[model samples]
Structures are given as C-alpha cells and as structure tokens.
Target: MAKDMLNAVKDRLWQWLSSDPGFILNHCERILFMNEYREIERQSSALEKMQLLLKIIIEKGDDSCQSFVDILRIHQAHYWQLQQFFKPNTQGSSSPTVVADGGSVVTAREMENIRAKSINMKIETVSGAGGSQCGNSTGQNPQADYIATGGSVICADKICNTSTDGDFNLSVTVKASTQVCPGLVDETLPSSQEPAVKMIRQHKEKLVDCLRSDCSFILQRAQVKELVTDRQYQNLKDISQSEQTVIDLIDRLMSNGQKSCTLFIEVLKEPEVLRTYPQLKDISWC
Candidate 1:
C-alpha cells in the first residue's frame, strides 16, 4: 500500500511537470524548503530517497544538486566494489581521509570544481578556434569584410585594378528605379478588410449603444425580482438569459444584409465585455 501511494504521487507530480515546464523550479524549491523545515517526513528507504533526489536533479538541469548526485554515485560504486574480487581501498589515512580505487584522493566538492574547470577550458578552446576560422574566411571575401566594417553594399559594383597601394578601387552606384507618388499609391492600395469589417467599423457606436441599453434593461428587470434584492448586483445567469435580447437589439440597429449576427458575436467577444463581467472569465469565445 505504501509503495502504491508513492507511485501514485510520483505519477501526479510527473504529469504536472509535463504540463508546465516552468513549474519544475518551483516544485523543487518547495520540496527543498519542506525538507529543510521537516514539514514532511523523509522516506525510510535510501533507494526511494535517491530516486526522488535524481528526479529533482533531472528537472533542475543545473549544478545546484551536484552534491546529492555525487553522494549517490559514491554509494553505488562502493557497494559494487565491495562485491568484486579486487576490493577498493578502505584504510584510513593520518589526514583523516581514505583513498578510493585508482589511488586518487579527492573530495566530491573538489571533483566537481575540476569537472567545471575542464568544461570551461574546452568551451574557451573551441570558441577561440572558431573565431580565428571565421576571421580568416571573412578576410577572403572583400565585400563581406567591407560590410563588416560598417560599409553598406548597394547597387552596381565596378572593380578597378590600381597600381598605387596594391588595392582594387570599388565604385558603387545607387539609384531609385521608380518615383513613389502618394496619391497614386493610396488609390492603388487594396482594402485589407472585407465588407463585414467595414460595416462593423462604420456602425460600431450604434452597436455599443444598443448593447448598453439592453444590459440596462436586463439589470432593471433583474432588480425587480424578489430573489435579487441587491439592485446593483448582476450574475452570469442574468446575462446569459438576456443574450438573445442583446442579439436582437444588435440586429435591429445594424444595416440589413451585412452579416450582423457575426458582428454581434464579435462585439460580445470584445475585451471590454470580458473586463466588465468577471463571471464570464471562463467562457471560451472560440
């Protein structure tokens, strides 16, 4: 039963982590805080604790959990070495430490630092080599080198061999292909909106007024009811029941043959309505 409960909790935690990648950091922080404060009891089994610690380390994707990882590695290796024919060194030294196999004596912290330094050295070496190669390649392309030095490449280029500085003279000419007339461009521009958008934009004010009036009427009626004693309060049910009335008001206000139903639906989906009605927060417009 205990193992089943642990598995269930682990499954739920994994599901939450998979749903939101950003939640892992918060989850790890919460777990660490709980462990520190003893808000939750620790696992009895070392293997269970190690499993949880490994999961947290994988989620963290950083060196913050290196100590715990090192501890687990040391325990696993020592366990295996004890069963082998050639056992590892377990003799205590005068300096209060014992050397493991291969005659190396280093603490987990020192090993971690050494690994970090080696990684940094490798990265720096690769970056320096790449930079030198890029520099040489760019130097071979005169046009690219000129652009890299803040010179713009435009239009036609004529290369002239000169005897002075052993450098070729590059002549570039830039010219506009056509003049732009504002009036002609404006007349030629295609309209982005369809006929429905144009109709909505033209009659937006009338639609807004109609909606406001319908809401006021619904509020007045709702206020008159004995159950609704508060005149200022309105709930989601009130708005839902009066939806048809608001739609009818919009239809009456809008011009005929303008696909006004879609326009009204769009108006209802506006940000202003959502802000005004907090109860409609969960409504899916799509």
Candidate 2:
C-alpha cells in the first residue's frame, strides 16, 4: 500500500513536470553536467527528455532531488500534495521530504520506482493488452528497465497496493486509459498559496521565450504598483537579454511573496499587455 502511494506521488511529480517541461529542464541545468544535459536535450521528445531527467534525479539519489526542488522553488500548494504522501506519523516519513538543511526535497528512488510503473500519465493511450514500449537502438537495451513486469503480483496499471510473491522485475507501458492522479487537475489550493506565482512559474517559459516587447511596460507597471524597487527595476531594465531579464523578473516577484505576484499578475492584465500576451488575460490577482 505504501509503495503504491509513493509511486502515485512520483507519478504526480512527473506529470507536474509536464506542466512546464522546459522550465523544469532549465532548473535541472543547475544540477547537471554540460555533457549530461546535452545528452538529455538531444532527445527531441519532451516525454523522453522528462524520462531522462527523472532517471538522472533517481541516479543522483536523495540529496540531488532536494537540491532540484530547492532550485525549482516548488510552490506551497503543490508541496501540500507531497505532504499527503509523506505523512509525519508514517514510516515513510523520510520517503520524500526529509528534515534536512532547513528545507525538504524528494528521494530519488521515488522517481525510480514510479517511472517503471508506466502509468501513462497522459503520454500515450493503450488499451488492455496492447501497449507501446520505449524503443531501442544499435543493439542497446534502452527499454530494458521500462519493460512491464509480467507474472508479478504487483500491477502497475491502477497504481493500487498488491502484495506479490516472486522475483522483482521492471518495465514501462504507455496507454490511454491509465489513471493519472487527480491532484494534477483538481484540488483548490488555499487562498494564500500564491496562485499568481504558480501561474507565472507555469508560464515562465513563454514569458522568457524572448525579450518580450512588453518588458518595459511590465517594469513600468511594477514601478507604479510598487512591486519592484527602483534599483531592481533599473537593473532588470538594463539587461539586454530577454531571457535573463524575464527570468530575473520572475525570481524577484516570487521572492517578494504573494502580494508582489498579485501585482505582477495585474501587470500582465493591462489591455495593451494582454494584447501582446493573450494567454495571460482573464487572470485574477493571486
């Protein structure tokens, strides 16, 4: 039962990464070697890229996962979901968020065990006995670790707890009917959980895709709304690179806490600003 729940949490984590694969990848850069990162980046498939990323997190074990989460700065609401899986009274207390370094991060084995489940997580649709396995190349066993376990009492499909008596095996299968965690799509976060920051974080890739033409206006609004200090605004306004400027902007906003993020959301809502970034429209303050 515990393993299943753990895997469910892991599955949720992977699916959450899907929310902003590029952003997650960017944070991952902080932990990866240039060569290792290049290898994952070359995959060309976001799913596979995510797979490789999770694999590395697993290989890096507990500490690296902690670092990755800190580097990502996961939001409190999402962190609450993880709390469900890491109940304090349970033996799994150290499962993901361990008490260390004044903060918490996930365990790498969580990534490892969950990846093998192949719960699909909306990646592919497979029905019943028919499922696609990850491909291989050049006499290599790339799919070796992801093959679905046969004959084990454990069933990875529904993510339920089942005790089995047999040697352990591993595999992955992709299918449509696979049940993903509802938390990914449902669950209302508490009002204080910085929804604005979550929104900005989720869209950070788009905001930083280029030096947005609205960069100056955003700074103007930030200054007007008192969201950024004059010094901070001038520093960001001076940066020529759109990417770093936007990244810094987000970092600063999130650092300032919920009120700043709320004002930042307002900046994105201006008629002219929304004209440049339509997706950011209809947003309410966090």
Which candidate gets the maximum lDDT versus the true structure? 2
- Tens-digit lDDT track for model 1 on 1-286? 3233334345443332232221222234333543321211133322343355445544554454544333323433222321221233434422222222111112221112121111211111111121212322211222111121111122222223313333322333323324332233333211113355355545545445545644654344334432122411232234454554343333322322234335444545557655654444443434
lDDT of each: 0.33, 0.51
- In candidate 2, position 97 carries an lDDT of 29
- What lDDT score is found at residue 39 in candidate 2? 64
Tens-digit lDDT track for model 2 on 218-262? 677778887766766776788787666677777656544456777
User: Which regions in candidate 1 have their CA more than 4 angstroms from the true location?
Assistant: 1-167, 170-172, 179-195, 214-286
Cα error, candidate 1, residue 148 (Å): 17
- For model 2 the local lDDT of residue 99 reads 25
For model 1, state the Cα shift of residue 114 in Å. Answer: 46
What C-alpha lDDT does candidate 1 achieve relative to the native structure? 0.33
C-alpha TM-scores of all predictions: 0.18, 0.31
